[model samples]
Target: MGRGGGRGGGGGRLAFVVAMVVMTEMTWGLGDVHTSVATVAQLVEAEHAVIFALKDYVRKEESRLETIKRYIWGWQDGRADYVHNPINSYHFLRRLTHDFDSVRRALHHEDLTQALRANITSLRGGVEAAAEADVNGAAYSLVRLQDTYNLTVDELVEGDIRGTKAVQELSADDCFRLGQQSFNNLEFDLSDKWYQKGLELMEAKQPITHEEQLRIKRIKQQQEHRILMRQLVTNMAKQSDGQMLDRFSGLGIPISFQRQIYAQHKDVAQVEQLDDYYRRLCRGEQLQPPEAFVGLKCSYVFGKGGYRWLMPLKVELRWDDPLILVYHDVLSEAETELVKRISTPRLATTMVHSFTTHQARRSLARVGKTAWVRRGDDRTTDRILQRVEDMTGLATDTSEDFHVLNYGIGGHYDAHVDFFDLDEKSLDKSPHQGDRLATVLFYLNDVEAGGSTVFPMLGVEVPARRGSALFWFNMKRSGKGDYRTLHAACPVLLGEKWIANLWIHEWGQELRWPCTRDPED
Candidate 1:
């Protein structure tokens, strides 16, 4: 009986061995088995321990790949850092580590078939998820997958997971190329866009770590510097034009008169000296004691005594040493008469009150005093206005309206635009049917210390002179508008300053009074 039992056991063993061999062969033929039969059989002897080990390895690898896929999807969707959590291998590694532990436990239990199945399913699911995520705008998962694959392949090729240094160098080179392209296009806006893209690519590189973050920061700094330089160039060009205008034609007036005007205003000279002193201070020069009352004084007057009205004013004395550009003031004799006529006390009161109450009949009234002196029409305003008109045969008609405003120190007019839309009833009672043409401001008195008409848009400052006026236009000949007419009167620093303003309206056949086109025959 014992002999029979032994032979039966041997037969059973042989049968089991044969069945295992056939299964292995079939699996190998189907390319499902990664290990040789000998190796499989070796593990199988201990209840399929070898197969379990093989399954464990595959499962861990699949989980790692899955983790990589997730990271790539995150990056591509521009959400890798959306929540302040960067998509990186470490993130994948955390998931991979957990999956690896599970595989290890299954392998230790000798569940070879189940472990292998889990690994394959996990890998397939990860790939599918990666594909879906990409379609939905997630790219970080794919990037993670590729990185992991490369690392695994490297391990397979060289028995190490870390990739070659060349991979890092290549990535850096690509980033450098992108940065260069942005810098060269002079498209600072676009360059910033590309530089950010390059930064992500550099950060995505695996195994090869460098000072990529620092390098990216440096690149951004360089881009900012380029933008600032471009702005500086533009500003310099504008300043150059202004300087040219200031020098040759005395900003439209003769150079001699400009010089004389500057000489007469001692306060202007002192303010200029102060500006120079400040500039020197910026350059670390020993500062000299500043004079008393160096800057402008601004104020506003709501009303006084029976005239309950609002009139804003500013006064500032412009220094003369580095004389800024002053544009031409042009006016016509007829226009001048119109200005003087309006300066009468009754007219001035009516016009000022009308403007304050928003009852001015004409847009021109909104701009000038009823009686403005036509300084620009006289020889004293600027020689260039006549020269330009004569050379271009522009058929110029210039004029000025003078108003004597007495405001004490610390008076200022808030910044405001001079152009009033003819269509806006709130601006003037009887709005001009045509566009505003030009403006001429005559400085009727040299302010004691401060009183300069400032055009912030043009960055031009006009100092007050006893008879000189500053001129500009609000409209172009083509009917286009200009933003240059926006101006402000800075604060009065020391004493009172009187000014004459002139606003020219578009020419039409309609005269203020009934007159024939050819005048009296």
Candidate 2:
């Protein structure tokens, strides 16, 4: 009901419920949808992107239909007046010359529906691929966004979040389905809230019953009788028009108004839970930086290589405990755009390593799509890897492929450590490729709103800025995994988020960053 009403009004009780449940289901998955604001500038270069293709088709088709409809309707309504206009006359000739052939071919088809079917068939493969499991996924995402942002059901139904507007308002039926989803997930409190809002909407929109209509008629007659008696008692002047007298009569009928509710904005200090830090940081609230980073200053890094000596990287020392730094202007705009183009075609659902089994599998904790691009995939990719080596002074030979990720609305990754915790017998372990020693994450684009790389334990939040890369050591100098380096990607509230990750391994960095005898080093 977010976009459509009941499928068939007369379909009995069971059918009505089914329609309610299915109507609000989103047509496409959020991860598959691209934001125009984020990608419109790259339209000429990314012509191969499916979103661009579809958008082009839609615009051309719509414009053609509008032109045809307007020209035909205007001619039919007033041919003389329409043709008298020089602009209209010119368009008439233009349409005959340009659009006539396409119109004739469509009409000549044995069945007019075939033209539509042919177009749909051409896009069916992509449509089916993008829509798989979309209903359940979309419902889950909406609920997650609701809980994370503390948004009220009324606010969401009205198509507003904090001050950002949704594309459209959700219908009463949409509310019912949302409540049903929450109930299925065993979120009773959230379910109750949605149900209450749905009921309120249904009651407000309910039409007057036959009995109520009859009661109103009776009341009107009694009031008329009373008016006549008063007229006789006072001997009032008789008005020729009784309709005018009816204007002064007051009939008490109740009208309903929708309830407005706003989400409570709590102070960052009041939020003490670990998960709360992620939400607060994403909301742009200031958090206390770690004490170790109090005296850290911005500086320049020439790495320990001849290549970087001429072009030192602008760096910001953000954290000191686990050694986190942000390298500014490390990537050019052209390079970032090329990475997005290469990764778009290969994007797939992101998978997480299971704690119990250590198997890579999909989970609700992370909602995004990712694709891996090795150094040889393209010259641009190779250049990016070389730049990573120069910036971090770490070898890229033992590192994994560049993992490019794109996050959609409400997309996020729960708190996680980057390094693998495998033993000798573990099947996931590679003999030569050591644990993930460090991570250099490049922000391909700037997020309009809430996408930030956050370290909840250290109360640190690094915002996504285009052309910037955040680097951090995942393991300690003593060759042990650092628990304090736990981090997560906060949910994207608005716009799009694109990132390329280069995970440097410990195998080739023995001398560059040597291990220490003291565990605390």
State each model's CA lDDT, in order. Answer: 0.40, 0.66
Superposed on all Cα atoms, the candidates' RMSDs to the truth, in angstroms, are: 26.0, 24.6
Local error of candidate 1 at 426, Å? 15
Off by over 4 Å in 1: 1-406, 423-433, 478-480, 508-521
lDDT of 1 by residue, 1-521 (tens): 22221233333344455566667678767664445786656646745543554455467546555654554453424433122111222233333344344544433333335666577568757342322222111122212222212223222212122222111122343334434543442233434444565666667666534576677678778767877875664455345543453333211121222233455555656434433432232223444334522553333333222332432222223322212223222234443344344454433421222223444332211222233333354454344334333322232343223344433322344345555545442343333334555555655456654456665543445566664545555654444455545565654433455566545555531242122334111
Give a tens-digit lDDT track for model 2, residues 142-230: 66667766777777787665575543466555565667666555454576677667666765765967765565456446445644554
Q: Give every collision pair in model 2.
A: 1-24
Q: Best candidate per TM-score, number? A: 2
lDDT of 1: 0.40
Total clashes, candidate 2?
Answer: 1
| Top candidate (lDDT) | 2
